[model samples]
Target: MAIGITAVAVPLANADVTTKANPEGIDVSSYQGSINWSSVKSAGISFAWIKATEGTTYHDSRFNANYTNAYNAGVIRGAYHFARPGNSSGSAQATYFASHGGGWSKDGKTLPGAVDLEAGCAGLSQSSMRNWILAFYNTYKSKTGRDVVIYTTRSWWSSCTGGWTGMGAKSPMWVAHWGVSSPSIPAGFPTWTAWQFSSTGRVSGISGNVDRDHFNGSAARLLALANNT
Candidate 1:
């Protein structure tokens, strides 16, 4: 070890996440713990989706805290619900989500809530799972007047839903693919609004690895979607 030499910084994981895209963002639950959102914003994170609720009753304990802090830190804030079709009716879940902190606004900054559909639908047949997803969307849209984003990997969606394309022309996708250069989304949603490219991403302000994401189009489009314009 030389005293005069400067050591180069090495990331703990997924150092190549920046190479995946330019205006990227993150998604977090209580998993990341307390985040230094100002530092996160200063590090070039453009937006964030925080876990808000799940099923018909359980809600993320840290959702409101993260939501307010992200807004105060100048990060575009959004909420997401971890689906549990087996726990209760999908409409009930949607209603529960909105009752919590999952409402969308026309502020041109807040993103509509996204429904995470994947392993939760595991073991259920494609037909039953599709019905549940439809039930969720129907009630969620009716309540929020905003289209919800669907998050799933191509394989998970295909296997669970038999590649169902029923939500045509409405739902945008937020596909997740860890450690990959690009995400492969389900056929149901032709284009994606966001791509969660890596979960092992190292970003400033967050102590551990965080999920990294890229918006499909420009930031303007994102704001437009938020505003529902």
Candidate 2:
């Protein structure tokens, strides 16, 4: 979800300490290549969001290995889909994502799937974009019986969706804002469920830069989310 955009960092004096208290996580894709899941778990990473499918045709080549290995290493993980609204209908993309690695189970280690919505509005109007996203969320929920997590930046959400607040109650927000003490919340969401605070974070298992995240709760709360309790 780190597309390399710079934003003004929020001036929170205790942001670093406050963020560190929450559960730590990361999001990875084929760009990270092979990873040592054991080392990653040992590094105190509680969860991960692995890229799964993009649009209706492209699937992340490393999704299977990362998905299986991360689970085996005892890291709670979920899959994510990159939105390509210009290429296909949201329903089709959601179906593709679910059919691929985005399916969820009741097992304690699998988190619900997430949809990345950072693309440039896909040439659609605000209303149309909102509908596309709703179609995706509805289809994904029907397929997995879980509300899909929505990932986007505050700027993109405001510009593209006209800061629509409808999804705040339905889906959890995973806001991405790099180099910030605190992430900027989008219009509808009262607070962020997950925050991708840095795109250039390094982990022992990852080769280069990986996206660093924090679940906005404790370990038990994260498990509750995974188990849907």
Candidate 3:
């Protein structure tokens, strides 16, 4: 999630290739406070992933406003869950996410829900962590009829899941590697579907630091993803 983390300047040499072709976006949580979606859209932001739920019981306090306002302002938006593997079963957390705000719809402005998979591996071994993630994906799919996006980093994926490659074919990857020319693709994915390039970004509507991202393709491709076309 990169919340509360120090931001590093992303190198222009590395970011130019992706940002030039990809749609600019951001990910926000309650930490971002109130946002002006119209200004965000006017500032050339195209999409967002807002924090929805974490673990099994904690819903992001600002989720509803962020989700609805982003959509109303014409920014393609989606919800994400911060995973908690050690506290409960993956299925439980996915169920909680879907019921809260992470459920997907066919509307052209809503992206499929994502699961944030970082923060110390949740004390699980590689194999257990892999199983837990698969369970969450499967449960979320069954509930929403859409594949859950996997949000992670190369180092975390490698260390926690032993570089598992099974998810590449089943889900889209939102790889996060801050301050880089290009994000490193995790083991299971050949390429990133979305890239979080910097955590210290300044967007028009967001008052504090926000995580900046890019959809790996054009705007139409992003629409296709949102609509599952």
Candidate 1 or 3, higher TM-score? Answer: 3
Model 2: which residue pairs collide?
none
In candidate 3 the C-alpha lDDT for residue 212 amounts to 96
- Residue 14 alpha-carbon offset, candidate 3, angstroms: 32
Residues 11-41 of candidate 1 have per-residue lDDT tens digits of 3231122332336899999989999988998
lDDT of 2 at 16: 19
- In model 3, the worst 10-residue window by lDDT is 1-10
Error in Å for residue 118 of model 2: 0.8
Residue-level lDDT tens digits of model 2 in 1-229: 1111122323233121123347899999999999999999888898999999999999999999999999988888999999999999999999999999999997778889999999798899999999999999999999999989999999999999999998988888899998878889999888888999999999998899999999887666676677666
Candidate 1 residue spans exceeding 4 A from truth: 1-22, 120-122
Q: Order the candidates by lDDT, highest first — what do you get?
A: 2, 3, 1
List lDDT for all candidates, in order: 0.78, 0.87, 0.86
**Better model by lDDT: candidate 1 vs candidate 2:** 2
Q: Over the stretch 98-178, how does candidate 3's per-residue lDDT look in tens digits?
A: 999999887667889999999778789999999999999999999998889999999999999999999988888899999
- Please give the lDDT score at residue 42 for candidate 3: 84
Worst 10 residues of 1 by lDDT: 1-10
